[model samples]
Every structure is written in structure tokens, then in C-alpha cells.
Target chain A: MTDPKTQTGSRQDEFEFFEESNALWWITLAPTTWAVHFVLAYGGTAVWCAKFGETQGVTVARLSIAGLTVLALGFIGWLGWRSVRRWKPRQNDMEDLSHPEGRHEFLGHAAFLLCIISAIGVVYVAMPALFITTCR
Target chain B: MIRSLAGSGRRLVAMALMMALAGCAGRQSALSPAGEDASWLHDLWIVMLVGAVILWTALNGLFFFVTRVRPNDWPERHANRLIIGGGVIFPTVLVGTLLAYGLSMMPHMRADGDGLVVKVRAEEWWWRVEYWPAGATAPIVTANEIRLPTGQRTELLLDANKYIHSFWVPALGGKMDMFPGRETRMTLRPETPGVYRGQCAEFCGPSHALMAFEAVILTPGDFAAWLEAEAAPAAPPATPEAQRGQTLFRDEGCGACHAVRGTEFDGLVGPDLTHLASRQSLGAGIMEVTREDLTDWIAHTRDIKPEVAMPAYDWLEAAELADLAAYLEGLK
Candidate 1:
């Protein structure tokens, strides 16, 4: 039989680990980065074309979009790498229900998967700039 | 029950086919493309339509097969394979291919930067046309009817004086928005000599439905001749009644909002009446340009088109109305 005080202390420790590591909150950064990149690329190109379409403005717009794509991909790759390192297989955990290391592992696995999907989404959105030479 | 469901599906498909066939013929139908730009758009539409039909049939066939024909005790690995292949891989390939194809065609849809330029300004319920010939000092101001030479690219500079409007000539090309204070451009090269109908695709105000125009694509010689005639002033009224009608037009304040070239009436508020009688339609393509229609339009302008800026002149005597219509009809 386990002491109730010991059980409460272990649960508190699990919650503390979850909060301090910020795994759950950081998972959303993948999609958030994709969304921000999409909006900036589309709006920047449209407004730039409307203002200065005939001159060197289109070159500037293309370069700016390329810079943003690289930055977003780099951030997502870093997050994915960090999550991959933290992720642990469920079999490695102790065969005890009260010890909840599985929860931390699950969070890491989800973050890693989400980051991959977000990176693919960003690339897909950037593909439009490759072929559309003009704003028309 | 299965037989009945199949019968209903057959009936639905038949009905859809009938409706599609019915929409194939019309003046404003994009399906009847008459120019290079429209031909490209039509080809794209056909490809997409064929792809959609195949996709829909395949998806429905898979659904039916899985539910009714497949064995219930299939292996778990098979089910997992189906989920990954049909759910993820198929959609990704399909959408990616479509996006690539659409992106490749974007640049080809725009103007090639070699053509004559025509400026079109969208008013509340009409169009103000200005011809900018090559190396001309000032643009030739015209209205409503746009005459383009067949087999030559013509670039249109579209702008708006008030609200947003869209310039759409279905047989020629795709629609481009006419934005106020900004100039947008579209190009069209008509392949045949015919009159195509155009309309303000954007809803501006109460009379939006009645705001229409015509694109007259003609032979090179005819187009040149027409342009020369349009550049000149209105021909003087020939008959006695027409001359009297011209006097009435000047005395009744019609000159305040309308302009007839080579005359003292140069109001810029309405369409130019330099060669009004030569046009095929009147009231912005709503009525034929006949003497009776003109008389009716003048007497009951508000009745024919509600909320138009032009007011009714019902108080004029019948003979005077006839004389005015004759004069306008002879301006060409």
C-alpha cells in the first residue's frame, strides 16, 4: 500500500514538470508560424504589386518572401529537433501507474509530429511564388 | 432498396446533364469563348471539370465497395494501409498536382505588353471610353460602345469614378475590377468579327442590372474607318424635324449633363452622343436604338429603369418628343 502523502507529492511533481518544460504550449508554435508566414507572403505581394508593380518592387517582394520562408523553416526545425530529443518510448517507463512519465513522452511526441506538419504547410504555401511572376 | 437507390441516382445524373446542356448557349456565356484569353480559361475549365468528375466517381465507388462489397473481417494491416494510402497519400498528390498546374498558367493570362491602349472609366451607370492611339497628344473621348479590331491585341486601362465595378466581356477574357483612383489593366484580342455583350459585373447601385455595353469586334479596315468617324464631331442634323429637335435639346437643358461633339453641348456627366444613332442599342444596351424606343425612353426614363439619374420628360408635347428623338437618331 502507498502512502497518500507520497502519491500527492509525485502527482505534484508531474504537474510541475509539465508546466516548467512548457511542452504543451510550445506545440502550437508550429501552426502559428505557418499562419504568420502565409499572411505576410500573400498580403505583401498583393500590396507591393498594387503600389509599385512596374518597377523593382516585385524583386523586393520576392526577396522578402524568401527571407521569411527561411526564417520560419529554421524555427520549426529547431522546435522539431528539441522535441525529438525529449521524446521517450513508452516501454522505457516503469511499470507503475502512479509514475506518469508517459504523459511527458506523449507531449514531446505530439510536438515533434506537429512541427513536421507545420513545416510542410509552410513549404506548400511558399510554392505559389515560384510560378506567379506577376501580380495579375 | 438498392435498386430504387440506383434508379434515383440515374435520374439525378440525367437531370444534371440536361441543365448543363441548356446553359451552353447564351451571349454572356463563358463556355463560348471567342478569344485567346478566353480559350485558355475554357481549356482550364474543361481539365478541372474532367478531373472533378473522375475524383467524384472514384471516391463514391470506393465508399460503396468498402461498405457493401468488402469482407467484414479484413486484416488490420490492410485497413491501416487503406487509411494511409486513400486518406493521406491520394489527397496530397491530387491537390499538389492541381496547384502546380494552376500556378503554371497564371503569367500567361495577363497582357503581353504589345497592343493599343484604351482607357475606360466606370461611372455610376455608364462607361466613359477614351482611345489612346499610339503617339497621340490627347485621347479620343467616346462612350458606351467599345470598337476593337479583330485579330489584334487591345489593352484596356480600367478605372472607376465612384464605386468599384468589374469589366467583364465574357467572350473576350476574364473580368478585372475597376477600382477608383487606381488603374488596372486587361487585354483582349477578338478572333472573330461579332458584337459581344458586356456588363458591369460588380453591383454598384439600384440600376446595376441595366448597366451594360457592347464590344464590336470588326475587320481591320472597318475598325479603322469607324475610329476615324468616331474621332470626328457629330454630323449636323439633316432634316427640318431633326434641326428643330436639336433646338429643343439645347433649350430643354439636356446639354447640362450630356455632350454631343462638334456642338456647344459638352456636358461631361452623361455618355457622349457624337454618333448615337449608329449604335445598335440604347439605354446602355437595355433597348434597341429605334425612334420609338428613344421616344419611350425620353418620356418614361424612370419607368423603364427605376432609380436612374436621368429624369422623365413626360411634360413635353408629343411632336416635340418626336422631333428630339429624330435629331438624336440623326447625329450619326
Candidate 2:
């Protein structure tokens, strides 16, 4: 007999990202955004400070970090929204081990929380631009 | 034997404690802050340490409570809340606040000067210091010691001769780098009037550790008087030995690389010895500026401070060396 999941042709199969049930790779997604933001903040600050010095460099660095922080937060927020929905907010809905959604819900939940952490980290990276203006 | 071993162990612990306590109060200690910049840094360090202890204890306490007190697996919502609140939200908020607080102090720590300027050029293992009085046309040049007027912000312009060096007077202020051909400025407003110590924080060469200076913080009036005296020429040698030593100093080509004002000994390489006796220490704060120390230093330049630019005058007779030392001591 054919599997009921195949027979029903559920919408979940169409949206399935991975071939298997392992969604562990999703955990790295949030922290990676933080890492990228960190690199951009430091490298861009160095370049701007070197090129423009104390006068124009401060404004340029501040704007760049502000822009980066916004873009990074937006991306993480979107990911968190999708991940949290899959994670299932209701406590009673969390124990359905047989369902594929609940099977991967723990990973999604972790990724969502991590997205919040990464957004905070992005803000951390951008903090120096708020006060530091001199190359010396 | 057992009693002896115990006694030795106790002595060792006492010695370690004494060393640690001594480290906390010294002329070159960051803990003993004598300026606004260093005090802010010390405060930041203390608060960060306290925050670290609090976080560590709380996190460990949570673990202890969970595993020992309530071993059962927590409810789904409670577990999620615990992880999110403790791991993510709490740490982020605490650390972010601390980072902002530390960054905010930079602007104040690096505040602009209040008219006084000091140019310090870092050579291989010595400091070339110049004091520019307000409204003065030229700087009063000296070496190996920095004298500042207390209660006023002084702008220090730092540069290097051969390689990169760092100027740090920990009790007075923070450290800044000195780059060759590039001038980096830092400001310090000394609050305590005392003789502090400074050192080259960077490793440039063999005598890097020996490269140190005295940071003398004086009252404004005293500083002005000292500067006035410093700007004058070297006095005539009084004693007969000093007079003979001056002749030796000139004839022996010591003037080729060292400059002494009011004399034909004008050289551009080594430190200015115009007022050498008035300095706090000889050989870049390495030893006391005494006749004995000066004689030993001359006889053993490389041995005392390894790789110093000064050549050993070991060929001179004992009498001749004494005469030279007397002449140098008469500079004040």
C-alpha cells in the first residue's frame, strides 16, 4: 500500500527544504548573520577611518553601521518569524512526535531564539560608531 | 623536615601576597589612578569584573537549582523561557550596556588639550621629550624624563625615530602608540603631584624593558621655575676635577653624538646632557644619578642597559672617569 502522506499530497512536501528530517543546519543560520555583520562593521570602520580620518570618517562609519544594523535585523526578524511559526507557540501542540512539523519543531525553536540573540549581537557590533570618531 | 617544609610554604604564600599588594600601589600601576582617564579605565575594569562574577554565579546557580533541586525535565514553556531569558536576553542586555558604557568614555578620555604641548619622540631605547610653554617660540628640549604641570590638561604629541613604540604612564593616563613619521596625540591632566614612572609599552629592541622614564608632576609655579632653569646654558665647572673632566669630555669626541648647551659639544644623535644631573635617573630611569652609578654606567654601558647607543668608556683611567662624573654632576 502507498504511504498516506504521498497519497494525500499534502502542501508540506512542496515546501520541504531538505530531503530528510534533519533541520540542524538551520541553527547556524542566525549566528552566521551576526558574524557577517561583525566583519562588515570592523572592516568598513577601518577603511573609512583610514580614508577620511577623524572629520568625515565618523559620520560615514556611523551611517554605514546604522544601515548594516537595520538590514541585518530585518533579515533575522524575517527568519525568526518563519521559524517561530513552525516551532508552534502552544505548549500542547509541542508533543506530536509522529508529525513531521513537531519532529523538527525543537530545532526551529532554537533557531528562532538564536535569531533574537544575533540581532542583539549586530547592535553590539554597531555600538562603537556611536561615540568613536578619532583614528588616534 | 615536615615543619621546615610548612614554614617554607607559608613564607612563599606571604611573599606572593606581598607582591600582589605591591603591584596594586606603584608609580606605574593602572590601579593607582592619578588622572581622569586612568580612573575611568580602572572603574570600567572593576565593574566588568563584578558583572562577570554576578553572571557566573547566577548561571551556575540556575544549573544547580535545575539539576539538584528539580531533577525532573522542565515543562516546555518554562524550559524555553529559561534558555531565552538567561542565555540570550540577559547576557545581551548586560554585555551591551557595558560595551556602550566603555565606548562612551573614549571621547572624554581623549579630550582636547588646554594649550600646553609636549612632544615626545621615542628612539630605540630612550625618550626625547620637549616642553613647549605657552606663547614660547621654541621648545625646551630634554630627554628620558617628562615633567608636567599638575591640574591642567597637557597635549602630548608622540612619534618614533626608528620603529613603533608605545608611551604609557599608567598612573597618569592611558597608553598611545608612537609611529615613525606619524604623530599621535594624547592628553593627560595630572591630578596628583608626585614622581611617577613611565615605560615603553611596545617591544622595539633589546633594551625595551630598560626603556623607561620618570613622569614628574609638579605645581604650575614650580614647573615654570624648573622650565626657566632648564632653558639656560650649562654652568661653568666649579671644581678643578670637573674642569679637567670637561676638557676630557671635549677632547675625547664625546661631543660628536651628545649635545651640551654653552659648549662646543653639539651633536645630534644621542640624548641632550645639558642638564643631566637634574634628571631623576640615569640610562633612561635605570639607575640612580649618582657619581658612583654614573662611573659604573660609563664603564659598563652595554652591561648595565644592553644595546644602549652609548659606547663604553672603559679606556679612561679611574681618575679621569671620576673627573668626568664630577663635571656631569655639576650640571645642576
Model 1 interface DockQ: 0.62
Per residue, candidate 2 scores C-alpha lDDT tens digits across A1-136 of: 8888886675566446452244577677779989999999999888888888656647777788889989999999988997787677665255663465566677677788788878888888888888887665
Against the reference, the lDDT scores of all candidates come to 0.84, 0.87
Q: Weakest 10 consecutive residues, lDDT, candidate 2 chain A?
A: A14-23
The candidate scoring highest on lDDT is: 2
Q: Which stretches of candidate 2 lie over 4 Å from their true place?
A: A1-29, A54-57, A89-107, A133-136, B1-19
Per-residue lDDT of candidate 1, residues A5-88 (tens digit): 999999998987877478778888898999999999999898899899877537788888889999999999999988776665
How far off is residue B51 in model 1, in Å?
A: 2.7
Per residue, candidate 1 scores C-alpha lDDT tens digits across B1-332 of 99999999999999999999879756676888877887877877887787778767877777777899994866756876786677656766676777778777777777463556899999878889998877778878888878888788888999999899999988888999999999988888878788889999999888788889988889889988988888899989999999999999999999988999899999988888888888878888788888899999999998987877789999999999999999999978
The candidates' DockQ values read 0.62, 0.66
Clashes in predicted model 1: 0
